[model samples]
Target: METCSIARIIRLQDLAMYRHKLCSLLFRLLPQLQGFPPGPPLKKLCKDEHVHVALTETKMVGTLPELPQDILMVIFAALEIPDLVRAGSVCSSWHSAYARLCNLGQYKQSQTPCLVYASESDPDNVLCLYSLAEKRSYKLTLPQPPIRSRYLIGSSHGWLVTVDERSEMYLLNPITCEQIALPSVTTIEHVKSIFDEYGDVCKYEISWHTGTRSSRKPPSIFALAELRGRLQWKAFVFPDTSTGSYIVVLIHNPQAQLSFAKAGDDKWTWLPPHYLYEDCIYKDDILYAVNIKGELHAFDLSGPVITMKTIITIPEHYDCDSRYIVQAPWGSLLLVFRIVHDHDLEPQPGASEYWNTSEIKICELDALWTKIKVINCLRDHVLFLGHNRSQCLSVNEFPALKENHSYFTDDNFLWTVGHTNNHRDMGILNLDDNNMEEILSPQLCSNCPAPMWITPDLRKMNLMGSMSQQP
Candidate 1:
């Protein structure tokens, strides 16, 4: 019995010594592994036989002692540009992560979504970057004084475009501050009438897209203009009641059918309306629009007629009406609406209210439009103010949550007000783990009241001015 016991003790001691050596080798090679759980595969790889044999043999399966910055950069570079901006708030290390990640090819295919929030106090608008990846915030300066007395529309390929109260159209780069004034009418006649009568009465809408099969280098910008004039409509009778103002702009495809009724003209004319309804997203040629019922519709730009799909719906009970719907970085659509809920008006017992006056709802697109959450009471505007709302939107689809159902896992978006101050915030909500982090708040900028809007064209590396000048 004593002999058998001695043998067993010796065997156990040998196994303990082997495990200790294996663990030491693994820790030396991949220190980051300490943070993760030890699975069977790792255990097998770290076994006594595996460790010394692999180290002694001429062949090592994988690289060892990985460079932290280089791996961070790879993870950083893989992130969408906007994500780096959001990551800026995490810490100084992440801020450095932000700068190194801005390589040219990152945004070659599609631009990042950048918005310039200009305060009357400051001549230039504050160029705030909303990264689609990390889904956070950072600040940049505008190229020149944004078209004064006009609403800053957005940018395409680093070019910033805007329209004024007088309806004047101007395009510039916020980064380099180069401004270009486009002609009143590119080719359409209704636009000419609006410009002539109203002195640029039509408001300019900008949609930025990358080249299709024809061009692969830089992205293209599509300008959409809404013309409000008395005109004819085939869909409606004399003076179509269904139509208040006709949308007249250069089509994205330049081949889609466009019909317009000019001011004081008796008849409706046919033109291309490809870019009229929806904003052009660069990834695929899918065009997106929101119908009167407040449902998001998407169609192929190359197709003859758009077969619109209702990606999401705005519940009628949402209280206030919604104007725009923006697709968020994390595979979800953000629906912005103006709600009028009275504070003095007592709330119903056992009732759940989302927002105050203007409510912003984040809905996950994949699963049935589940209202992930909403932001109602934003800093000090009591009595439910339904002022102005627009969609500052972008989507990044990487480092996604393990489960597909979790939409908020890695999503980000932007919102710019018309009259209210340009207050911004970065929100991070992971439904999978139910983890939500919001840094840099809208309330922080309540003192800096500025009107800002988003530009679709967000490319990195190039100066904003040169990017605008590109073909």
Candidate 2:
């Protein structure tokens, strides 16, 4: 009996040492885990959960059902993107722990990007998210009016710019499922709602004119169903640094015009420039816009008056099908040119036509020299360019991403009409070889919104704090 007790004591001592070493390693790696407690990094055990490790000297011993949930979370949180996703799939207990961490607003600093699209199976309400790390598609349900019917023009800071059936706009946070209504589309200076005999909005008459060269052209009439998405080419949402409230910049039709609205504004304020702005981005409190002719402009909305400052001269040729602006990982600004097939250089965008992007050319803006330099290789960064806000992520941070590659989606609005089920034009492009290969399964490829990329996040917004001050 004495010998047996001695053996138990040794076993307990071994277990104690093992736990100590495990904790020591985790604490050392804690500094690397982002969003860790603010102060000195330390192992924080969940007080409610104790494994019941006894020294055996007291003649008491117990076993845990599994590793403590809190410890499992710490280890899972520190894992690389793919491993963390796999860890959650290991067992039910692990999944719960992972879910808790995700629910706790842990959109880790290096958030992994997910392919956001709508599926026909549950098209009206479900959003299909394809995770690159896990190579799996997950469905998330957003608040009412169904994501399928809405036009997702852009996604920024985890919120999507959705245009509803009434041609009204909103900012929707996919993870937290929060919605903020924007100014009505009819509020634009050129948009007029045409009411039917029953006093319901059935059509819209929007004025169209060419920049600087043409007189006012006859208005174009669009039915309510088509006008919902046809009104805007793209939209972007950003926070006004001065007020902490959000500002939404829109690239609308009537020739890709520029307009903006504050968080609580009753109407959108036009920027007065009609240069056919193709894409826009907000950085360092300045809004940078790129036009169809590759001209770059900057606007400071906080001032008493908004003036469009020309940063770069207009390009001589307009061969590039689409132009996108993204801030590089290293802080330099880049302009990406997406070109489709050679034969389809001037292909008209028809209601049912699909566009498959063929090649992508990147150019870095030499701000100091005021010239654009063509970059043959993206180096360690990958570009996600298409309908969603243009994004550039580093390859070092996301191991799943291939260097010098571009993952593109169908930014063409004509193919993504809510009423139809059409195959999307999305694929991964190898810059080195200019070869494109599809990665999505056949089913996911047939969805609405055309497979744009959005970085998955669970950050809760302080809607009250985001309310804009009276302009």
Best by lDDT: 2
Off by over 4 Å in 1: 1-115, 124-147, 155-160, 164-166, 176-189, 193-283, 303-315, 323-358, 362-450, 453-471
**What is candidate 2's lDDT per residue for 1-471, written digit by digit as tens?**
354345334434554445434433443433333333424212222111111111112211121124467756665655533334444543466667767776674526466677787666664777876778657666666788888877788877667888777778888877557788888888987789999899988888887764454545688898876786567867877767766767889888777788898766899998764567878888656799988777888888777787668888645343677888888878788888888773332446764444577788888888573987788998888998877778888888788888889998767656544424555667899999988888687574546555677764445455446432211
In the range 1-74, model 1's lDDT, one tens digit per residue, is: 35434533443455434533432333333323333455444444333221110011232323322224443454
The TM-score between candidate 1 and the true structure equals 0.38
Measured against the true structure, the TM-scores of the candidates, in listed sequence, are 0.38, 0.76
Clash totals in order? 30, 0
Residue 415, model 2: Cα distance from true site in angstroms: 3.4
Model 2: pairs clashing at backbone N, Cα or C within 3 Å = none
